[model samples]
Target: MNITPCNTVSLFLPLLFFLILLLIFFITPFKGNHFSLFVFPLSLSTINDKNITTTQVQVQQPHQPNMRIKKMTRLDRVEEGLAEARASIREAIRSMNYTSEKPEYFIPKGSIYRNPHAFHQSHIEMVKRFKVWVYEEGEKPIVHDGPLNNIYAIEGQFIDEMENSIGNNPFKARHPNEAHVFYLPISVANVVRYVYEPIMSKKDYYRDRLQCLVEDYVGVIAHKYPYWNKTNGADHFLLSCHDWVPSFYECNPQLFMNFTRLLCNANTSEGFQPKRDVSIPEVYLPFGKLGPPNLGQSPMNRTILAFFAGGPHGNIRKLLMDHWKDKDSEIQVHEYLPKGQNYTKVMGLSKFCLCPSGYEVASPRIVESIHAGCVPVIISANYYLPFSDVLNWNQFSLEIPVAKITEIKSILQSVSRNEYLKLHMNVLRVRRHFIINRPTKPFDVMHMILHSLWLRRLNFKLTNSQ
Candidate 1:
C-alpha cells in the first residue's frame, strides 16, 4: 500500500536493523573462514615473539605379571639342577672303593746324606734307619725325596729328569733303572713370582688358580704322603695329611701329580685281600689346647666365635674386623692362644663357633667346634665337609653370604632368641661325628679314602675280566 515519507523512513529503519543483527551473528570477524582461523593464532605468536608447541603421546603396552613369575621359576629350576649335579658327583666319589697299600717309594743314588734341606734330611734319616725294616717287615714305602738330591743341587735332579721326559722326550726308553723315576722340578723363582707373591697381593689370578687346582686335583682325585711311623710295618701312605697338600697342588698341578701317587684313601687294605666295603668316618676337627675349666664352665655367654687368624689366609678375621669390631668390643678376640687351651674351652663355652676356610680349607677348627657341642658358623663358598646330606646347615648354624656382609647387623637382629637356642641344641646332637680322639675318630678320613680307592680297583679288574 502507498505510504507517507515519515512512515516509509520508519519501516526502512526497522528492516535495516534486522539485517545488521543477522550480519553480527553470522559474519563477524571472530567467525572467519578456515584459513583466517588458523592464521589468527600465528598473529598472536608474532606479537609475543615466542614459540608454542604441542606434543603427541605414544601409548605403551600394559605389563604382564606372568612374565616376571616365569623368569623367577626358570632361575629356581636352574639352581635345583646344579645342586642335583653336585650331589651326584659327590655321591659317586664317596661310594667308590679305595686301597690301603702304601705306594712304593725309591730314593735316587747319592741322595742319602748329601741334601741338607729339612724335608730331605728328615727323609734320608728315616730311610737309613727305617727303609730296610720297612721292606723286610711288610709293604713298600712311599718315598718322599724333597726338592733336593745330593749336597749342592739347588733343584732336585729327579724332578728335572721327570719334567724333561714328560715335556721334551716322550719316546725315551723306560729302562729298569729309570722305571721308578718320576721327579718333577718346579722353579722356586716361578713359585715365588707367580704364586706366593700374587696370592699375597690378593690378585684375581690367585683366586682363579686356587679354585682351578682344587677343582681339578684335590677335589677329584686323592694323593699320597709318607707315613710318619715306619717301624711297625706301616708302609702305607697317610691320608690324614691331605690338608697340607693343597698349597703344593695349587701352585703346580702337573708337578704335584709327578711326585705324589694318585690313590684313594678308603681302599687302603690293612691286609693283601681287597675288602668288599669299608665304613668311612663322618667328620674330623683339629684345634689348639683347651681353655681353663673355669672359663668353659662359667655361663656368661654360651657363644664361642672361633677366629682363624695370625696368617695371610685370614678372611674370617677380616670379616669380623669389618663388621663386628665395634659391636663386639667387649668380647676378647684371642688371635693367638696356646694349643692345649684353644679348642676345648672355646667350644665348651660358646653356643656357636664360626668356621671359616683359610687359603686352603676344611680346617680342624670345624671338627673341634662340632665336638665341643658348639654349632659352626660356616662362612665358606665351598665346604668339603663329608656327610653334608645328613647335616642340615640351616638347623645347626646361620650362613651369612659374603656379598651381603654389610647386612650383618640386620640379619642378627632379625633372629629370635628361641630360634637361636634351637640351633645351638641341634649342633650339640651331631657332636659325635667330629670327635677325633675317640675309637670312632673323625680323623679316620684317611681310612675312608683308602677303602674307596680299593673298591674302585676291584671294580676295574672285574670289568676287564668280563
Candidate 2:
C-alpha cells in the first residue's frame, strides 16, 4: 500500500511540532520559569529587565525575509509604558548623587539601604510613572473595605489610603487602560469577618468558601475583562493581611501562582515567594488612635535590655513563651502585659524588642518596635523580612533562628554597647519607612509597601498566548 502524501506530511507535522516544543522546553533557561521568565517568539518584548512578556508592537526579527506585524492593543501601550519605567528606573538607579531639579521631601540614605541612591531614584520613578487600576467589582466590607483596627488594620489602611486617588493617591489609574498593574481590592480579612463567620468553627468550610470566592472573583474578572486572560493574571494583585491567606492560597494555588499577592503572613514555608510576591509590614492601628504613637525612650534612657509580649499562638511562640514567659525581669517576656503597664511605654524602654512569629511569620510588633526606636529581634524560620528588597535588616535588627529560643538573652547581651547603639540609631532611621502616615509621605509605610510592589512590577514583562 502506497502512503498518501497528505497523511505522510501530517505524520511529520506532529513530530515537527513535538520537536519544537521539546527544544523550547530544554533550550531556554525558562522551560518552567513559573511566571518568572516566560519566553515566546510571538511576544512583543523589550529586554530591559531579566524577564519578558508578550508584546503587540511590530518587532522585526534580525535577517528575517518577512516581518510579522502584531496589532498593538491597549495592553501593549501599558506594557510599553512599564518598559520605559523599567529603563528609567534602572538607568537612574546607577547615579550615585542623583540630585533632581526639584528636591524630594525625603531621600533614602545610610546603612539601612543596600543602595540608598537606587531606592531613592526608584521611589521617584515609581511616583512619576507607576499607575495601579484597583478593580471595583465587589461590594464594601469585603471587597473595597477592610478592618482598619487591631492587627489586621494594614489590609484596610492600605486600601483606604489609596482611596482610588480621589486627590489622595497619585498612582491610582483613572482608567483601566492606563494601568500598568491591576489591583483586586478583595479584602481577605473582611472575608473571614463576614463570609467565614457563620462557619467559624469549620476549617474545611472556611477553606472551601474561600476557594469558591477566589474562583468566582477570578471568573468574574476574566469574563468581564481581557487583562487576566492576557498574561495569566501576572500583572494583577490582591492585598490580604489575614493569616488564613497563606493556607487559603494553597487551596487554589493555580489561581495565585501568577498573581502578585501582598501578604502579611509572608511565610516562605507556606508558599510565599519573595521574587513574585510582596511582604507588607503588619501595623496594628488602634481604632481610636490616628497613627502609631511616638512612645520610645532614647537609647540613653532605655533601661530594659530586651522585651516581648504576645499570646502563644503558633509553634514558634509556644517555644518562645514556654522558654521565657515571666522568667526574667530584665528580659521582660510576657504572655500578657502586667496590670496598668502601657505597651508602647514598655516597648520604648526596651533596647531590643523580640518580634516572634505568632500563628504567622509576620507580627505587628516588628513595626511597633521600629516605631518605639527599639531594635527588633526577628525569631522565626523561613520568615522573609518586609521591604528586604531595599532595606538591610542586619543594620537595624537581629534575626535569631527558631532553634535558638534559649539563646535570645545571650544574643542580645553579646552585642557591644556601641553596636547596640548603632542598631538602635539605625532602627530610628528606618522608623519612617514603617510609620503609617495619612496621605502617605515619601518613604512612609504605605509608600514603602507600594515601593515593594513597584519593584515586583518593574522586574517582569507580560505576554499574550497568541
Q: Tell me the TM-score of each prediction against the true structure.
A: 0.37, 0.84
Give the alpha carbon lDDT tens digit for every residue of 1-466 in model 2.
8899998998899899999999988978532212334332111122244455533322222232433986676756766876765555556565465545467877777899877877777788778778888888988877889888898888888788776448768888888888888888888888887887766455635577777787799899989987777667778888888877766568777767678888888888888988788889888888866456788998889999999988898999999888899999878899899999999999999999999888778898998899899999998888878898888899999999999989888888999999998999999899888877777778888888888888877666554323
Per-residue alpha-carbon lDDT of candidate 1 for residues 1-466, written as tens digits (9 for 90 to 100): 8899999899899899999999888876442111001111122112121232321212122355544344433213423433343233233234432222243232212211111122222222222211111111211111212132221111222223322334243312243111111111223323333444544444643445433533343322223311111111111121222222234444654433212222112222211112222222223321332211223332237644333323325575576556644345223234554457654665677655655555443444555565555656666554433433123457666776666655554665576778766766665554433332211121122222322322222111100000
Off by over 4 Å in 1: 1-316, 326-346, 438-462
Each model's lDDT comes to: 0.35, 0.79
Q: Residue 93 of candidate 1: its Cα lDDT?
A: 33
Ten contiguous residues with the weakest lDDT in model 1: 457-466
lDDT of 2 at 19: 95
What global local distance difference test value does model 1 have? Answer: 0.35
What lDDT, from 0 to 1, does candidate 2 have? 0.79
